[model samples]
Target: MTTMKVTERVQGMGGPGRGGPFGSSMVGQKSMTFGPSAKRLFARLAPERVKVLAVLALAVASVALMSIAPKLLGTATDLIFEGLFGKQLPAGVSKEEAVERLRAAGDDRVADMLSSMNVLPGQGVDFGAVGTVLTVVLVLYVGSAVLGLTQGLLLNGVVQRTMLRMRAEVEDKIHRLPLSYFDKQPRGELLSRVTNDIDNVSQVLQQTMSQLLTSLLTVVGVLAMMFWISPALALIAIVTIPLTIAVTGAIMKRSQKQFIAQWRATGKLNAHVEEAFTGHALTKVFGRRREVERQFADQNEELFKAGFGAQFASGLIMPTMMFLGNLTYVVIAVVGGLRVASGTMSLGDVQAFIQYSRQFTQPLTQVASMVNLLQSGVASAERVFELLDASEEPADAPGSAASVSRGRVEFSHVSFRYEPEKPLIEDLSLVAEPGQTVAIVGPTGAGKTTLVNLIMRFYDLDSGHITLDGVDVSSMPRRSLRGQVGMVLQDTWLFHGTIRDNIAYGRPTASEEEILAAARATFVDRFVHSLPDGYDTVIDEEGSNVSAGEKQLITIARAFLSNPALLILDEATSSVDTRTELLVQQAMAALRSDRTSFVIAHRLSTIRDADLILVMEDGRIVEQGSHHGLLAAGGAYAALYQAQFAGPVVEEESLV
Candidate 1:
């Protein structure tokens, strides 16, 4: 086929584009080395092997058909040339001279075949044969295009479905992972893996996978056809392969490291953006905007350097390969012309060989470029699998029933540490009988929150048993145990939803009346009605439209709706004004009257009326008694109370 015809047929097949020495295949690729991660990726793709095989089959057929067109067009060229010029041989030419002249104009095969079927020196060329060849070329081109489009459509489905499942798996894996997994990782980094990295993998599957396969097949088909036509010329064309490899090897060795650095910098940049944006208000309040911007600029500069290095290196492959290919083309032209003049090859064969040479080298260039895309794809896959393979939360004990009747909770000799080197909680034991209010007060980092976490089974104790109603909390499914316990933390989280929806989050089936009752109990109903949308107003992410105290009340309403056997209020009302605090205190008193409650507070005034109070310092409880009893004893609780009442500075310094 002519270069124009071939170009049109392979346009969608990711053939070299116009004006670019290497085309997008090479330029857009990231790295050039597939690592062990590729094996796992292939294994994951194995289930779709039948579809992939079909794509390969279509690619092979398409390349094969296109390959045959060039040779056929060459034959047609010779037939027309000979028919027009055969009769014009010099007058009185000897038979041997005539034969040599005919042989010089065409290949020995075509010359002998035409001579055997001669019509006469003056007979016109066979237009019908040329028309037939043209028709077959048209059909092949059409068939190849149809197959290519079909393959693209099929692969698109496969790729989208694969990414869908992969994303879902990652999301599920996130839930299964222990809370500790999130403790050490930046939320933005994990977000990058789930989004950006997976997107890269999807792009490779959708655009590069079929192209890589077709390019390989085209290279092989071209090689076979080249050898069939003339082994000598094919060998000359093949010489460029080693040169291409050498150029690629030298450039990619440096570029691969850059690709890795680029992606790492990308993740860091994303993390910085997430933090900066999430805490923009705090950053502004603290006058740290300049510092945050500096950090961001540093990350951006790193990404630019790494990205430029990678692109600059990979970009060299195309132009360098193109130059070598052109050099090969020149050699073929000189040698083929000599052979044609020597009566061994035809003019048409020389033309076809040149076209075949271009076709052959194009795939080599494409495949070389594909190496980078494949490696980048594999790298992204590795990040994704890292999450999928992370340690999951330990499974709950089998056959254990979820039966917590009374709200009694006990922490029995619970020794725990976040890290092995530093023990945070040691031999801590506590018990709250049903319907008793147990208030825990502590200095910052005194393991008060850690103690509550153990009771909620958020983290398993290092060496102790936390039981709910005499049943080991670890034995029950985490979901079931957590369902019976309600916690309202200081950092009130409200998703982007209506005020009513936020309150009803823990009990979705709660009726409108039930929701309103809980909201009223927590005083959430006080301001909600003053808003334009009433309870239906959409809360922005982080509840930016609402005050912190309002957000805290909404969360309290949520916990109240759950009506769990056990309740935890961790500075739940610290944001409210005195009036609202008294209202909340009344609500808390009523709620705590029938359920076990653990109240952790920095403000000494909130839990003074508790049935019991435990004062903690340095991960150990230093004092425990009723509010009056502790004050009378002049212990840690009394000292904390005195500091708070004495002065704000003293209170801030004395309490966490």
Candidate 2:
């Protein structure tokens, strides 16, 4: 399978517009491989068979009831025709005689009475026999309809339950996968699996059971009656079977590839639309309106073409089978008519064969109409399970610790890279003594964020050793590694809730006192108090409720409340206003006094006072010393200091 060079996920579903304007190409990616597990899943659907069976039974009964009434009328017509023409029968007495005799002798009172009433000439009974026949027919009709309604209720319940379980299973699979899995997927495509794919499966499930059951039962029952009445005509009817099947099968086979194309095109299209919406602000600022629209139009055109092809192909089978159905009916009539005249079959027998001919074709046509749609649903099901099969991070063994001691960190000969031999960090080594502030400063994309990400175990290093209190972070569980490391990141993400909720999110179990303490220290409490609701105020999704500066402080409070021994502040104030920056600095001072902290900052002035300053370049530490000592050496550290620190410093002596 070929792979796309994906950067970020757009959407997580498989639907139209996956590659709308910003998504990566969905081509050359892996296709879902169906296997034994897929068959097992079908077996899991075994219990749902009962619902299908009920629906089929109801449908068969309805069709059979309609078939029976037609023949019963035909039978009464024969008895009257014979009695009036040449036998021992009274003139103008045939209708009453047909009704009274059949009701008493044949247990077909309803059929006879209906035949006595006029229904339609050259069809069935007339209206005169309506009362007696209708009473019983109404009961049968209503009963069958009631069963059909019940089947609908049962079918819906089964489909809904199956989709619910499948959705939960898909969710668990998504979170279980390693972080790299998301890099290869678009959020909209993945989202489609949960929302659109599952929804499509729901529609198929709603109809399949009833359709399968009714068609099979009615077809079998009708063919059986036809065979009993006259094997000759029934045998002739079977010849049209092969032709009907070939037509339907060809339609299905052709539609399969088109559907697969439709599915892929949809994923690509969604990827683009998701990207457009997600980076809408960037697009607006850059004035990329025409460019974005052109991109969208390109992806959408591909989706529309593929979708139209699949739907158009699948839709034709219905009419083709219908045309063939009429042809089959004509052949049955011509062949059956000769047999009746030649005394080879009785009039009633000929009548029965005609009814069965129509009944039998009903199923073949129904199955023809729905088979392509059925396969599409199964194709989607296959995709859902394929995702469930993706590789995931190993679950941590039970008994893994979730606690931390006094913050102490050490990285020994640490090295990492996204690609082999293209090192981002080369033999990087550093130490943050317990309760000391160590700052790492470097150019953009110089492995600064990568270092913090490694500490959190977001990605494993190629060759490196990071430890906390002499314990190897790698050998320990990821949960254990992350539990001991707290960070205030440069990019602050807020959820839809109160400012209080955002801070408390770090440690949901933290007490109100701890939360307030963390907030007060970070100066978040000050702004929150300025607002009408204080800590009770609600916020928008992603912290749209506050300024970027305030968002940073709220994040600081989150880190503080977690109270991890090791704190990494990566550009905490780089994007904030000067006013909030000072408040955050004071909060940092309070947080770092008793913790071992690694501060990675671009603003040289912010970290110059750190106990140790490490100048990094090309993944190597070019200089390391105290701020004044490095400045005295007139090296890289001195140059970086000259670039950023024009502000008045609180002298070391005054701070001490």
Candidate 3:
């Protein structure tokens, strides 16, 4: 039951799914269980791939460029400090007063104000030194900004393209999938994968991956510059690298699992809401509003907790890394300052050490926070690949023609189960001549619908074979075989279009006169004519304006207009009132001429006129004859007939 429902929802997912710098490795082998079939699903987005690589390169360069500014500022401080605080510098006035005069001679703010890079009131600078510092900044800092912009644009492009490609492939898979796949999932659950899951990937791309690359570059570049300034200080700063990574990695790995659970729960929640809304009438009639609301509330709350848990946990990384990084920086700065005061290092070198210390921690902090983003992108990628890698039906046989007119159909020792353990049909064999009507009558779940499903090639049988004009359906093109079969279900589905469009659906080439002829024969023309625009009257999805019987009649009109060589009618008049049933029956009868027809009926009177009647039990045909022959057999069919049509002559008459 679970599998069948999922496959049904899967069919409705004939659309896209979502992901983005989506570093997700493959989900645990579910996609790969389909083998080489999965390869076709992740159609390569080469442009996105190129841009991702390009942006990563740009990010590295931008980080390197940014590291230059701190060093240049350090250089300006050293030059001015040497001039102002030489061997016999003014002692009583204080270092602050000495630095103030150096700035007036062009040492600038690097050796003044609240740490380096200061603005002092009444301070003046040599124009030449000011121009020199500004020049270096313009060359280095401006270069970093330009590179950052380029990387940002490219990363955005790559992420968007990857998502588009993923969605396209998932959608394509949906259309190509066998009908049975649809029975396995929910419509809304599948929808969430495309929209919500893909968006998660995009979010990572827009926010996380870029941060990760930039931070990684910063870490690398800052370390290099710190080494240039003071190898001793740089080594001290590197002490926390492994511990930081271990902490960040552990937090992200755990959150990845939570994020998956969160997304799955969110999909379930969406599925529940969709189910409630779609079956709103049932919920109201059963007075189940509170029940549905409670169910929704539970699922909604679960999503909230799971989502908040995943994000809240991931959010902890930045602050934790920041604190650890700052602690490391303070340790390095104090040790380096003591060395400078002992004359073991120059003031210029000490200034440079402090600048490099800032470079070390800040970049890694950015990198640490991006782990969460990377994890989300990866999780979404796994979901997308899951859909794409699902099993698809076999390709049409080679050398099979697209068009074939052999309209005869034969069933040979056929048996089937939606799943292996539960058999629905077994060892049933029958044949229908051209222009003959073969009616199959059985209780619900007796394989009446499964038999029709096999004929249309909607599913492959587990045992034996079905043939169209002696050609095995499995060996022929599925499309060619189905092209010859026109089916009408009890439930009529109408798209948002005109009445004429609905009738002409089967054959868009059909003329207005032909559509009218079909509608009139089905008695839909009567009601359609009553509408303001008659045949041109607009309809909505599922045809809300019409009665169930009227909708079914219109669908029958469409089938008639298509003029299929083989027609399958399942419960043709099952839902209609007696009057509408009568009208639809006339149309059904008209549609059966000169064609191979299969009728599955519960109303025995409708099948009495069929060329042959097969009574099925437990997936096999137990009785085969005319209506009277089966009635006389005194078997399961007879028992069922009497239970439904026994007692008195009037009771039997009521069946008519």
Candidate 4:
């Protein structure tokens, strides 16, 4: 029931790989590199400097408390050991007397071991001292836990607020981008950048920011504690640092490339899926289901390969780091045991040093594992930043002209092209006097729609100017120039809302009476009153509940409600039935009274009464006159009129 213009089909055939409007293939697009992207991502947090500083300070304090707790536990261990073994000594002997006696008895090793224990020869364990040390350790852990929780809460707030601002800026950028930009980019690709990529960026910030800071601080604190306990053991532990760095650095460098490829494949896949869904009915009717599915499978496989590479590379970090850490742990234990036996270090200090060694390596492992999230996040951030950095539409002229008083429109030597070398409309000149109905007729790709687009300033002229009521459209604010124009395209768009709300979209502040008047004038009232809910009937998301003709009528009502000075109808009757077309043509006739109207139609029957008829070919007007006059002159218009109405069917090429 819907007509597909030849021009539209031809345009669709040229997409992506076909060297159409999209220009280049997306196969080898490269994202920004990791170093610069990470820098930019962190720069976005500059506005929350206070919160970030607070989070860092809390991380430092928490790690400091947790780092000291293990040493205190070692103290408790010493107390219990001295208490348990002190029972072997002779009763009522002073500690110095027993040590001298042992030395006199030729037990020098035992005497020295007793000296290292630092216990009275006859004393049992001090339960009170052990209890006190354990109590202090418990308090330190609880304080560290509290500080960590507060830091997480503050960090979460900072990330959410930054994401909120980023989403708003992206939306504003979308509005400021030129229509030509959209012509080259798929809706799905842009949508993935706005939604999926931003969400990934948010997740990365929330998960990695605080944990990365804590792990780094823990490394510094634990290393300091390890050196304080015993420098030799600390040096043994530090030997593995260079090896861990080398392993992590190598894995991260390769994983980052795969991560970028993964996200790019994701965007391309999303674009394909969105296109398929939007055109599901057409795809099924044309029996292109298998082709669509094959394309999807191919893209899906690409995503899987890229994702596997990224994950496998990043996954190597944890196990390799753990293996290195275990080797360091074993070395530290053997050396510290020898030192304990030689009486160069106390049993308590050696125990504390072993715990510090584990703490030191654990943070390094943690940081290595977090590199995966960091790389993925930076990859997504680069995509979002690319959108933010895209070339925006030129700014409107400063102190521009405001409103148009009359609907007079003139295009003086206007020239433009979507591609620089392939001019679509060149040196086109025309005048639409106020209150005149100009009906333009031509075959597909004759630049009918392009001419209307120029008048509306959807694009700027490469050379020449468009004037509205003697005021150059470039000088006027886009909002002001577009405010006085109403357009009804062949495709009817309706959001999920009530019938009345859709009609009122054209003039948000219109009263109930004004809306009713527009509906009646556009024949929308005829259908609305028949429905059970009248004006309040809700349209579904796709607006599929209503027939196509009803949808077109509603759109006409919307434009009618606006009461714009200049009106444009582009194949507006192409979707409706013959009876419905009659109603639409009648409504359009009423709407055109006292208003300058530009109607582009392929149906010659519908425009015979137009005040002016223009026949265009190859971006130029080949003939122009009133409908009767053009036919009587027997030129291109006459041939087109004969082809449609009177003669034997003429070939489309011959008419052109």
What's each prediction's TM-score? 0.89, 0.81, 0.82, 0.93
By lDDT, is 1 or 4 better?
4
Clashing pairs in 4: 83-125
Q: Which order, best to worst by TM-score?
A: 4, 1, 3, 2
lDDT of 2 by residue, 338-380 (tens): 6655546555566767777877887888987777677677667
Candidate 1, position 319, lDDT: 78
C-alpha lDDT values of all predictions:
0.78, 0.71, 0.72, 0.85
Q: Residue 571 lDDT in model 4?
A: 83
In angstroms, give how far residue 1 of model 3 lies from its true place. Answer: 31
Q: What overall lDDT, based on C-alpha atoms, would model 3 receive against the true structure?
A: 0.72
lDDT of 1 by residue, 605-654 (tens): 88988888988764457788899999999988888887778778767778
What TM-score, to 2 decimals, does candidate 4 have?
0.93
Question: Residue 175 in model 3: shift from native, Å?
Answer: 2.4
Off by over 4 Å in 3: 1-47, 79-125, 339-355, 402-406, 497-501, 509-517, 532-538, 627-656
Model 3: per-residue Cα lDDT over 221-290, one tens digit each: 8888888877888888898798788888778766877777677777777777766777788877878788
lDDT of 4: 0.85
Best TM-score among the predictions, by candidate number: 4
